[model samples]
Target: MHDSTQSRRTARNSLLIMVCTLLSRLLGIIKARVLGSVFGATAIADVINFTFNIPNNFRKLFAEGAVNAALIPAFSSLLGRNEKHRCVRLFALLCTFQSLLLIPLVLVSYFYGDGLIAFLSDFDANQVRLGGRLLPFFMVYLATISLASIFNGVLQAHENFLHAYLSPLLFSICVIFGVWFLSDRYGAMSMAYSVLGGGLLQGSYSYLMVRRYEYRFKPMLRPQNAPFKEVLVAWALVSLGMGMQIITQMVSFLFASHLSEGSVTAFTNSTIFYQTPYGIFFNAISAVSLPLMSRAAASNNAPLLRTYTRNSLLSLLALLLPSSIILFFLSRESVSVVLQTGNYTLADATLTALVLRPYLVFMVFSAWYALMLRLGYSANRHALMTRIVFLQNLLDIALMWVFLKLGLDIVSLPLANGIAYTLGLFILFFLLRDLFPLTKEARFFKGLLRIVLANLPVLAFCIFYKNLGLQWHESGSSFANLAYLMLIGSAALGIMLLSYKIARIPLLSLLRSKKHGGNLQGDNLIHLD
Candidate 1:
C-alpha cells in the first residue's frame, strides 16, 4: 500500500513537472522562432549560438548535470534521516563555494573571451570579434544559474518540483521580451543581454522558493563538513562524466564551425527542435524519479529501485516511440511551420530538417540513456556512470571525425551522436542487468512490444497522409500550415489510440486516472514502485 501511494505521488509529481516543462519548452520554441525569423542562418545567428554555447554548456555542467546528480541524492538521503540542520548547513556551504569558484572562472572567461571563442569555433575575424564582445554578458549566466542549481536541488529534495521546474519560465519570458524590444536597436547582442536578465530572474526565483521551504543561506566554508565533503567527491566524478557529454556538443560546434557560414545555426536549430519533446517527457520522468530512487538506494531497497527504473523505462518507451515516429514523418513540415519565417528561408529549413531526421531516429535510445544515467546516480554508481559517459563521448567523437573525413558534412554530427548513444544504452543495460534484470520481466517486455507493434498503424496513416500531397506550408499561410498539421496530427493520434485499444494497452487509462486524481492500481498499470 505504501508502494502504491508512492507510485501515485510519483505520477502526480511527474505530471506537474511535465506541465511546467511543456510551458517552458513552448516559450523556448517561441524564443527560438523569434531568433530564427530575425537572424536566419546567418553569421549573426552563428555568432549568437557559438557565444552562448560556452555559458549554457557550463550551466548544464554545474547547474543541471553534475551538481544535481551529486547534490540531490545526498540531500535526499539527509532529509530521509531527518537531518534538516545538516542539510541546511551543507546547502549554505555549497552556495558559498560555488560562488567563489565561479567568480574567478567568470573573470578569466571575460578577459580571455576572444581566445576561448576562437578555440571553440573557427570563426572569421568579424564573427570572432562579435563572440568576444558578447561573451562577458553571457558569462554572467554561469554564476546566476549555478546558484540557481543549488536552490533547485533544495527544492527537489523537498519534492517541490513545481517551482523548481516553473522557474525556467522566467528565463524564457525575459529572453522573449529582450528579443521583441531590444533586438531592433542592439541587434544580436540584445539576446546576450537578455540571457543575463533571464539568469538573474531564474536564480532569484529559485532562491525565494528555497527560502520558503525554510532553507536559509549562510556563507560558511567548513572543511570538516562531512556531507559537503561527500558531495564534493561525488560531484567531481559526476562533473567529469557529465562534462565529457557536454564536450561532445562542443566538438560538434567545432565541426559545424568549420563548415559553411550558416552551418552552426542549422545544427543548433535542429538540436532545439529534437530536444523539445525529449525535455518534456524523458526529462520530466527522470527528474521526478531521482529523489525516490535515491531514497530506495539509501535504504538498500533493491526491489524498489528496480521497480522505479523499469516503470520509468516503460513509460519512456511508450511515449517516446510515438513521438519519434511523429517527428520522423513530419520533420520538414514541423521545421517549416515553426522556424521558416522572417529571415529564415526554405533552404535553411531544408537543411535543418536533414539534421533533425537522423537526430529523431535515435530519440528512444537517447531517452533510455538519460534514464539509465539517473538510475546509475541513484544506485551511487557515479564511477561506473563516469566510465560509461567517457566511453560514449569517445565513440561519438571518433564517429564524428570519421564522418567529417568521409566528407559527410553537418548531418554527420547528429548521426554520430545517435549511433554513440545507441551503443551506450546497450552497454548501460548490460551493466545494470544484475540490479535490474529486465529480461525476466516478461509482462513489461510484452507490453513494450505491443506498444511498438501498435505504432505501425500510426506510421501507416502518416505515410498515407504524406502521400496525399497535403502541404502544410502551402500558400505561405501560417494558419493553413498549422491547420493542416493539426488535421494530420489528430489523425495520427486517433490511429495510435485505436491501435493501443486493440492491443489492450492502458496508457490512455493511466493518463485519464492521473487527470481525474484517482488512485492508480498497480495491476492496472505497470507498477513503478
Candidate 2:
C-alpha cells in the first residue's frame, strides 16, 4: 500500500513536469515562428545567433551544466540530512562566488568581445566587428541566465520543479515580442538587445518565485561547510562534464570557419532546428529525471531507480528514433521552409540540411547519455561520471580530427559528434548494469521490444504520409498543403498512441490515473517530505 501511494505520487509529479515542459516548448516553437517570420534567417539573424553564442556558451558552462549538476545533488544531500540552515548558507556562498566569477568574465568578454569573436569565429574583419558590437549586450543575457540557473537549482532542490520548468516560456516570449515589435524599429541589434532585457525579466521572475517559497538570497561567502565542500567536489566533476560540450563547440566552430563563406551561418541555423526537438523533449525529460533520480538514490531504492531510469530512457527512444527518421527524410524541405527566406539563400538551406542529416542522428544517444550521467550523479558516483565525460571529450576531439583528415569535410563535424555519443551510450549502459545489477528488470527489455514492434508500422505510415503531403504541397493549393500536413502529423501521433495501447505499454497509464490507484509501483516521484 505504501509503495503504491509512492508510485502514484511519482506519476503525478512526472505528469506535472511534462505539462510545464510542454508549455515551455510550445512557447519556444511560437518564438521560433516569430523569428522566422520577422528576420527570415537573414545575415542579421546570423549576427544574432553568432554574437549570442559567446555569452550563451558561458551560460551553459557555468549555469546549466556545472552549477546545476553540483548544486542540486549537494543541496539535496544536505536537505535530506536536515541541515537546512547549512544548505541556505551554501546557496549564499555560491551565489556570491558565482557573481564574482561572472563579473570579471563578463566584463572581459564585453570589452574584448570583438577580439574573442575574431579568434573564435575566424570570420572576415567586418563580420568580426559586427559580432563584437553585438557580444557585449549578450553579457546582460548571460548574467540573467546565471541567476536564473541558481534559482532553478534551488527550486529543484526543494522538489518544486514547476516554476523552474515553466520559466523558459518567459524567455521565448521576450524574444518573440522583441522581434515582433522592435525588429523594424531597432533593426537586428534591437532584437538582440530585447533578448538581454528578457533575460533580466526571467531572472527576476524566478527569484521572486523562490522568495515566495521562503528562500532568501544573501551576498556572502561561507565555503567552509560540509555541504559547500560537497558542492565543490560535484562542481569539479560537472566542470569536467561541461568541458566536453565546450570542446565540441570549439571543434564545430573550427569547421565552420573553414567551410564556405556562409557556412558558419548555415551550421548555426540548422543546429537550432535540430535543437528544437531536442530541447522540447530530450532536455525536458532529462531535467525532470535528475531530481527524481537523486531522491531515489538518497533513499537507496534500487528497484524504483531502475524503473524510473528505464521508463525515462524508453520514452526518449520511442519518440527520438521515429522523429530522427522523419527528420532525415524531410531535412532539406524543412530547412528551406524554416530558414530559406530573405538573405538566406537556397545554397544555405541545402548546406544546412546536409549537415543536419548526420547531426540529428546524435539526438537519441545524447539524450540517453544525459540520462545515464544524471543517474551516475544520483548514485553519488560523480568521480566516475567525470572520468567518463573526460574520455568522451577526448574521443570527440580525436574523431573530429580523423574525420577531417579523411576528407569527410564539414559534414564530418556532426558525424564525429554522433559517433562519440554512440560510444558514450555503450559505456553508460555497461556502467548502469554494473551499478544496479538487480534493477535490470527483464520486464523493461520486454516492454522495449514491444514498443519497437509497435513503432514499425507507425514509422512506415508516417513516411508514406509525409511523402504524400510533400507531393500535394508541391502541386496543390496552400490550404490543401496545410490540410495534408495537419492530417498526416495528427494521424501519426494518434497511431503512435494507439500502438502504445495495443502493445500494453504504460503510455496511457498516467491519463487513467485514479485517486486511489496510488503509484504504478512503490515510487515517490517528487520525494518531498
Q: Assess each prediction's global lDDT (C-alpha) against the native.
A: 0.81, 0.72
lDDT of 2 by residue, 356-405 (tens): 98877788888888878888887778888888888887898888788888
Expressed as tens digits, the lDDT of each residue in 1-529 for candidate 1 is 6645765766777788778988987897689878888888899999998788778777777778788999999888788777788888898889989988889887887799888888889899989889998888888887988999899988998888888988889999999888789988999888888998999999999999999977877778885544887788889999898778777878899999999877898999998888888988876778877887788778777766776676677778777888889888888888888777767887888788899889889998888887888888877788898899999999999999999999999988999999999999989989988767777766557657767898999888878877887664633328778787777778888888788777666552222122112222333444454
Worst 10 residues of 2 by lDDT: 520-529
Clashing pairs in 1: none
Best by lDDT: 1
- Report how far residue 81 has shifted in candidate 2, in Å: 3.7
Query: All candidates' TM-scores?
Result: 0.85, 0.81
Candidate 1: count of backbone clashes, pairs at least 3 residues apart or interchain: 0
